[model samples]
Target: MTRLLNEEIIKKLVTMHDANRIIDQTFQGFGNKTVINPSKVSLDLGETGGYPFHEGFVNAMPAYIGDMDLAGIKWVSGIAGERREAGLPYISAMILLLDPRMGEFISVMEGTYISNLRTGAQTANSLKYLGFKDKVSIGMYGAGEQARFQLEAIADLYEITELRVWNHRRETAEIYANEMKQYVSGETIICNPEEGEKAAQAEILITVTNAQEPILLREWIKPGTVVFPMGSFQEVDDDLILSVDKIIVDHPDQALNRGALKKLHKEGRVTEENIFTTLGQLAIGAVEMPNFQEEIIMCIPIGTGAMDVSIAGHVYKRALEQGLGENYSFINYN
Candidate 1:
């Protein structure tokens, strides 16, 4: 039998806290070599040729967690513009869990929520392993749905007293502010129109933008700030990358191939020597946490399928235990 779970049902099955813990454990498994995340296969479609002409892409991400004996694949699709005008999510996905021993499908679930939620949970776990707590001010670039999840997940573990947001469009920033008022005080949510200076001058700076070039400069980063450039391409400049006290990433291969430092990696200016550690190492205590209070620590979380699959496995089990999802028999050949 295979369990079928939709986004709404999956949401009920896994909370942010659950996702955070699962992601932490998964990272630990990654560090200990009990987890495997293969490189994703991507199919890129040229521009849409519409108003925004956002590029479209689909990715197939597969993973296996040996300790738990869970294996899965996620098929996800996204576009640059996300069809926002038509009221659709930027990313939509589906996750299929398989019994590793038999390679048989055990469950299939909606993956968009899981995808957005787990990425945020991973970032929060990174902060936890890095030792951040209490009354943190957050500055964010790119006020979008993913940004909301980041703040939401972090607020579960920390006290967010202030939130400063910057977006290319002012209306979206205001919308984000209104949407995030539950976690951050309405009075403290400042929407910045300038070139991301006010947003960058916080204790925890995050960039979720889709910018191909750098928007955050080295000068804006304070001595004690923790930076997370969570976008696909470069959001922070070379100076910031070179000056950070410690550089941590989710995976070396993914980080070198994409994300903020990809350009530097290609230029032979950055390599494993430049990265201090990975989030997995930090989670497993293989690497010591840096002095986040006195140093500029930047964590580049390019995200991984291992985290998603692990969370999916957890959610599937929980749903089964609670009888939350619909069950259907599979491979019924007479």
Candidate 2:
């Protein structure tokens, strides 16, 4: 029995990102079967001053890494509210990793950071499989932490010659571009509002904004563009989705519902059957990746508790081996 802290989780997560071996290994090793109890609503639990909203999710997810000979349960709570003046995130969570063999509480940590990284990595991994490794014209749609991580991961994979970034606000986009210019190899170009699509016609496109409606139109997407849409949950327009000939996702089951693809499916424009392949299936050689030509290939991510648990499982082992976090009891009584 042991406990891993947020500091430990964050530390190990960063190390894992650098360790492409671990990212690649975990990307290929883990699998989860999730059953989500549809979101339940409760009124007036707490004050979210200045006009706020709250949405909650409860899920029981069990997962395994057959090669690692490890399995765990990651039960999570998703409560996201509009940002209050309290200076906190809009979404927060908790994850408990329990050992299936002994039923011990392996770890407990704040899940917000983990959720962002793993979800971001899921897209990064997809890009590794489907994106152009040699090309470098990069365009990112959002300028959040997820956006930063996605760009970092992309730079790791491709020879980014230009990083064209756009957000709704000019000042914010400039700040993000300036911050990025310090680290990445290429120039960080910021686009004005009207020029978003004009800037999007790069070798690679990453849409990570909190966009409710599709910001990048279907007709505007250039050929051979690989769009890694990070935050589009409800869905995108029919034209944008149907216009793309190929689709790839992290988990078909998860993305097929709460992601852009499902919204496309519901519109009678596309279905689960339309999914060409998934990253995991392709990684495992379960599905074959076709010749990715000059087409707009899309990878829509649906966040999963399994992604959290698997990453936690990896961190628990590596951090312990390196003598990282404090030890605590994880006991279960029958």
lDDT, residue 280, model 2? 61
Residues 213-247 of candidate 2 have per-residue lDDT tens digits of 77777777777777776664532456878788788
Best-fitting candidate, scored by lDDT:
1
The digit string of per-residue lDDT tens for model 1 on 250-306 reads: 888878877788889999998889888988888888888856677899898888888
Task: Work out candidate 1's RMSD over C-alphas.
Answer: 2.8
**Which parts of model 2 are misplaced by more than 4 Å?**
16-19, 30-61, 73-83, 232-235, 330-334
TM-score of 2: 0.83
lDDT of each: 0.85, 0.64
Best by TM-score: 1
Which stretches of candidate 1 lie above 4 Å from their native place? 47-54, 81-87, 185-187
